[model samples]
Target: METNNTKMFTEMFSEFENDAEEGQKQKIEEINEILDEMDEAEFYSIFTKEMFEKIDQMIEKKKLTLENAILLLKHIGYHNVIVKFFKFDFHVSSLRFRIENMITEEEKKKEGKNEKPLVDLCECNLLLSNGFISEPIISVCVTYVLKVAMSKEEGEEARKDVEMALLALSNTMYYFIEQKLYLKEIKDIVQYHQEHRNLTRLAYQSVWQFLFCRLLCDRRLEDVILNKLQFEREAIRELEELTKCIDWKKNEDKLKEMEEENLLERWIIALNIYFKEFQIRKKEHVVLIECIVQIYQASRSNYIEICNLCICLLKVILIRKNAEIEDLLKGGAVEAVLEEIQRPTLDDEMVYHILMFFVNASRRLKEEERKEMKRKVFEKLEEEGYEDTIASLFETFDFLNRKYYDELSLDISNYFVNI
Candidate 1:
């Protein structure tokens, strides 16, 4: 397979290199078809050191267009060749310089020819997707697109060109988030466009997609939240600004609004990350609990998912060895869970997490305190029309109960009987 693929790829390149203008469309189509059918192993088999050097030489000799070189790089550099081959950096650097020069050339060209390089450079951006291209190159592309977006062009042709550039940049945004060298500038560009130009909707969304892409791609998604710890004094201030940016009350009132904002879901995701990754410090704990409780209380009907998340966040925080469980109780966290569980729309998930919250909070207390808290919780449940739910708690399987309370789980289970 290796020898066959190598021979085929080498022959195709030989044909293209020997006659640059002969059957250009046919050759490009043939190259695309062959590349489409080639899998990772077959590709690696054919793309050798000699082929990379030859392509580099062709670019340096001006025998092949930079566009064609980019195409070749896309095919040969698949499956992390850029990362594996040190020599590929030369090709990458050359491509970067070409793209920068293209940007400069586009700036100097009149309207008629300006779109030509935009189309070509857009091709370069698409080829640079995956992991083959370096961050510096993508940063250069992003910086160029952002500059185009920022320039105050007056005519219709210029505006259309700028929009095209933004759309092109949006197409490549998934590749842009890996580099932080220009992230702040990229964000400021997006924010500026969002604030200053209603016409830049496409550009703004592309930059926003960059952030969402980073969140999806990052394995440690909570690191953003964890980094906030360093700014403890300003944490609440920052959170307040975030909270005020959206009208939560309006969101609570309308389903469409809630779905659009999805603020609670985003907040819960952050909380879950902090719950899993970091110890809940006193200040962080207080702020988180207060935030959760406030969001839960202010939330209206059909918010079981958010309610359950708040309960789970509470449960995780309560279980922490250094947790100030008293702060949660003082903030009416118990009442919030109890209220949510007794709501007519409650589901198994909500009940389960809330019950886990009780079990966890109970185990951390002294025997007398545990019994007292359990008694109060059951009384509240019964008063809130949750007597049957309380009974079901005792009848639940031991494994589920023990998972939260160990041996004390049985005692807690039995205590439900008397209530």
Candidate 2:
């Protein structure tokens, strides 16, 4: 079987399909050799310089200046080389200041404390922004250490390295996902990060970093993945686990984990998912219902989530209570949903949703709403109704149509022809 590192490389290469294999292989090999004698970062600078030089030479031959060649290559896809060059090892460009501050803070710990003053952190930051095609570089950077944590011998020190690497990886990936080049890579890293809880700091870092990345990733990714992003999901569960590598003596990391484990984070995730739905269709009222369902099931205990849940619940009651679902049937919305939910051998969960949908139909009732509904039904039945009454019934029925449980069993073949 391929090792975890090999597997990660495979995942990263999944994109850039026509990757000049011979070229990239020769490139990484030549780059690695040069890096071996110098620094891993040398690979990033050298490869970038060499490739761009050659591209510039070619462009210059065509009479284009170096800057124009660079710009044109970016527009025409040679930017992949720069992206690949980042795959080696990415040290945080700004962690020194942050680490120093954190170290100083550690020295001033209130009382008895065991927080290690990050003796030394291998600085790795690849100044990535959300506007470039650098997702693959992110994948390669993060997976380097994760592969070790997942496969190399199990040890505490190795785990800390893994955790730190992952934090930096996740930090970089936020920029990658925002850049919109490699979701397949982000998904892979998320899975790896969630797999085990190493240092409390690392574990919390992975979760926060991932949640942050998810917030920044392609809205389309969440659009399709909304239902599947749950931590309970195997693919996610496999990566979302907390390993035993964290240094809990550091109260900060432990506190961070505790904070993230609460429900407020989930509320944000749910909100993110629903926002994407709204983006796709502005008047998709059904999304409100869907959002509520997700929020209700989310076992979040954070007060912020609870408050948000309360607000969302109020919205649900406002929209759904005393809703007139009858006109919705006539308006074609009800028919559209029934057609999908009425499938044979429906999944149990979906069936439960249908049952609850009807149950909700029975609740949220208002006496005036019912009277108005009855008046509309009678008017529809009476062929003797005046023009005013006819218009009123149409409007009234549409309101009721939103909450009514009546089914529209259009013949399947007729449904196709009518459409």
Candidate 3:
């Protein structure tokens, strides 16, 4: 079987190398002309392995040197050939099935020299302290591996690789952005992440990570003032292309490892990086605030995280003094926070945060929009049979100047320049 397998692949390679277009003399001659001029070594820049063991070894050693392949191709300086290989537009799945079956029969040939047919990413963390271009390409391959896992019906395993690749992609992409300082690509990446509204419950919180990672893609994504974070991707050019990627794997084991060491808080603190680096626009800034609001309002998580989120929102709303915030109250932001506070037996701390959320919301409104909102609130009250409640609430906040100004001592370095 092993001999047969070797013979089969050898035949395929020979056939591919020396294949003819049977009916077309012109086409056959063209292929010949190209092959005749080829530097065999450079053409085999991405060498195929007869043994999966060798490929697995390279991947395990973290020495699957695409460097040599990259260098060899660069030496050949033939972009057309490389482009032609990738641009062939083969459906990945059909080709993958073809490869899988072929690899399977070949694997069965080896006696007692086998492990798992698929490489174990968990056993080997393929991290490289590497370059910008290398990073994105690695991410592209990581995503491919994850797809393979998913196709094998290992969603849990696939998610782990996806997340790993995401982190790698982040490291790589930022390096590229920093190197090129290409504002257009940066913004495009940002917009792509922003447009990915992860409706999955896990995504809402993870969205900020997406923003923080991408912010450093071109311009930094942190805020110095208020020592905060924001996600503004208006600088990237082809965001749709960048963000068209699938979500990273959720490595539950990783989540558990981090949780044991109280690292989850640090994860939340990543938002501070974004808050510090990018100029948080009104809409983007409010998203962080609103995410916190929604999380707490759901009354689903533990008290500690909810409290931390409330406190952060308090600081953000106080510092920003945004005008577009009235829309949140309109969109039930007020109601959500209020619901959290009034949950069966509400505590004083929670109540205090709820009031602060209101105070911040009030400060965020423009005087005119506030009045219109105020008038609408009363109308809404009438519509809802709560006209009496409207009057009381309106009278309560009428004196209502409770917004915060940016602290005078705030350092510009601490805040991201909108550039």
Best by TM-score: 1
Q: Give model 2's TM-score versus the native structure.
A: 0.29
Select the stronger candidate by TM-score from 2 and 3. Answer: 3
Q: Residue-pair clashes per candidate, as listed? A: 0, 37, 28
Off by over 4 Å in 3: 1-160, 167-296, 300-318, 343-419
Q: Please give the RMSD of candidate 1 to the true structure.
A: 13.1
User: What does candidate 2's lDDT look like per residue over 102-212, in tens digits?
Assistant: 444544578864332222211132222222323334444343334432433358776655554444444344453443333454455445544653334433334444544
Q: Worst 10-residue stretch by lDDT in candidate 2?
A: 74-83
Q: Write the per-residue lDDT of candidate 1 for residues 192-264, one digit (tens) a residue.
A: 5535663333343344334444444564433442352232333344345444554554544443344233433
Question: Each candidate: what lDDT?
Answer: 0.54, 0.36, 0.36
Residue 387's C-alpha lDDT in candidate 2?
45
Report the candidate with higher lDDT, 1 versus 3: 1
Off by over 4 Å in 1: 1-256, 300-302, 320-322, 393-419
**lDDT at position 329, candidate 3:** 61
Tens digits of per-residue lDDT, candidate 3, 296-355, equal 443234435534554454444444544246546644555455445324344444444544
